[model samples]
Target: MTTPVTIVGAGLGGLVLSRVLHLHGIPSTVYEAESSPSARTQGGLLDIRDYNGQPALETAGLTEEFRKLILEGRQAMRLLDRDGNVLLDVPDDGTGGNPEVERGELRQMLLDSL
Candidate 1:
């Protein structure tokens, strides 16, 4: 008998698990509550952690595709106070791999890769 793993939600974690399972020739289904892909707007960008998110993406075979979703110059993050004054601005010199892309776009890419 073969055991099955059930996953809920199509977010980053769920999608990543699905992809890896597929690579291993394991069957799985993703249960997303959303009626449609565009049912709701995804959250803001995410800073993928080097040890966690990045490695998961690599395992899911979406590293290359995910790279495309990387918004150019989005890495230039800024820290602002309540007054909305420019407290600090860090320009992305294309060196730091950490990128800031819309969560929806990234999710779409991950789903497509799977």
Candidate 2:
């Protein structure tokens, strides 16, 4: 008999793992402290890139869905001083592998996939 996979915390990592496992016909149970997705604020944006995050999404077969969530021009770099002065600003040339998307949206997409 195969041992079941139990993933703690329904955050990005756990959710991705669950989705990937599901795609490969593996079963996994995810445990999250929150009562529901809206129980707490999902918080902030995420930068998914070719090197790290994007690869994981691809493994889970979410590349197309992930692309739909990409927020253009979010990879632009900006450096700020203590006084809120902009030291450097660089626009996203569209080649910067990383693209930003809302964390909640990504989480929801993974959930829906499962």
Task: Report the number of the highest-lDDT candidate.
Answer: 2
What's the TM-score of every candidate structure?
A: 0.80, 0.84
Q: How do the residues 23-101 of candidate 1 rate in per-residue lDDT, one tens digit apiece?
A: 9888888999999778988889787766777788898888888778777886678999999999999888877756666
Candidate 1 — which residues are off by over 4 angstroms? 77-90
Local distance difference test, per candidate? Answer: 0.83, 0.92
What lDDT is reached at residue 105 by model 1? 88
Error of 2 at 102 (Å): 0.5
The lDDT, on a scale of 0 to 1, for candidate 1 is 0.83
Error of 1 at 10 (Å): 1.3
Tens digit per residue, CA lDDT, model 2, 1-96: 556799999999999999988888888999998999989889899888789999999999999999999998888889999999999999988888
How accurate locally is residue 52 in candidate 2, as Cα lDDT from 0 to 100? 92
